[model samples]
Target: MAMRRTRILFMGLALLVLACGSTSGGGDDAMASGGSPGKALYNMNCTLCHGRDGKAGLNGAKDLTTSTLTKSEMVAIVQNGKGAMAAYKQLLTPKEIEAVVDHVRTLGRKK
Candidate 1:
């Protein structure tokens, strides 16, 4: 239970940072630009809820490591979100979304 609370608190703080950091002259973190962009983006934006390995399942997040969703299906879910997950359609570009989905697919293959 405490772990869940800690996760929630962390997510809240991350969101706070995102909100405060946004400005009219917006720019993404360097992680969004190059070198394992998917993993980097996921680390910064998703680990709190979906987790580094995509099994945290916090706030109704699904276990990506075990998800049966196809790439397109997962892309839709990420772009639109569900339940407590925030829609990334506005936050992430289409290519980044695809990259994240590709990374998610790898999670299911890990032993």
Candidate 2:
């Protein structure tokens, strides 16, 4: 009986480890879906000003959900800084900036 209980305990622990390993905080899913990295980056950097859905407009930040800017235009503004917004050029890599831009585009589609 003692050995059987120990085996069961080990099996339960192993199952828990497997479950944890297969789960993520969503960052991996976002990347796997081709936009999660951008979403993660946006949440980290833009959510405060743009709001979670990009319509917050705090501190004079634009309502990205309604903006009609193209990807290139958005990238330029993000890289160069616009009005009250600080430039990300000194802070983020080009790829990261692009990811952020991609994330912003999703905001416009959220309704």
Candidate 3:
């Protein structure tokens, strides 16, 4: 039974490592971190320039309020980047990019 127990322990440790490795991908981080996917991602990545409330307006960061870009357009801009904006395609997954787009939509809301 000693060998059997060792094998089981090894398998459990392997599974634990695998789970921990994949957890950093943001699937669970999104839920546990609080805030929506976009809000979390934006806070981590975009808030420096765009501002926390989305209106600090640093370095000519275009007021998201005035942006004419639709959600899809905004996603493209984020993925591809504009004049001064750097593209985030490499830093974030497509799902994370979509989360940012959805979060931007909520800017300027009353609540």
lDDT winner between 1 and 2, please give it. Answer: 2
lDDT of 1 by residue, 16-46 (tens): 5545545422354443333345665577678
TM-score of each prediction = 0.67, 0.69, 0.64
User: What TM-score number comes out for model 3?
Assistant: 0.64
Give each model's whole-structure lDDT.
0.73, 0.74, 0.69
True-structure lDDT of candidate 2: 0.74
lDDT of 3 by residue, 1-111 (tens): 995565356445544544554656655445433546566667656776788767877876888865777789999999998876767776667887898777877775534
Ranking by TM-score: 2, 1, 3
Query: Quick one: best lDDT, which candidate?
Result: 2
Residue pairs whose backbone atoms clash in candidate 3: 38-99
Clashing pairs in 2: 30-36
lDDT of 1: 0.73
How accurate locally is residue 108 in candidate 3, as Cα lDDT from 0 to 100? 53
Q: Where does model 2 exceed 4 Å of error?
A: 1-35
Per-candidate RMSD vs. true structure? 7.8, 14.8, 13.3
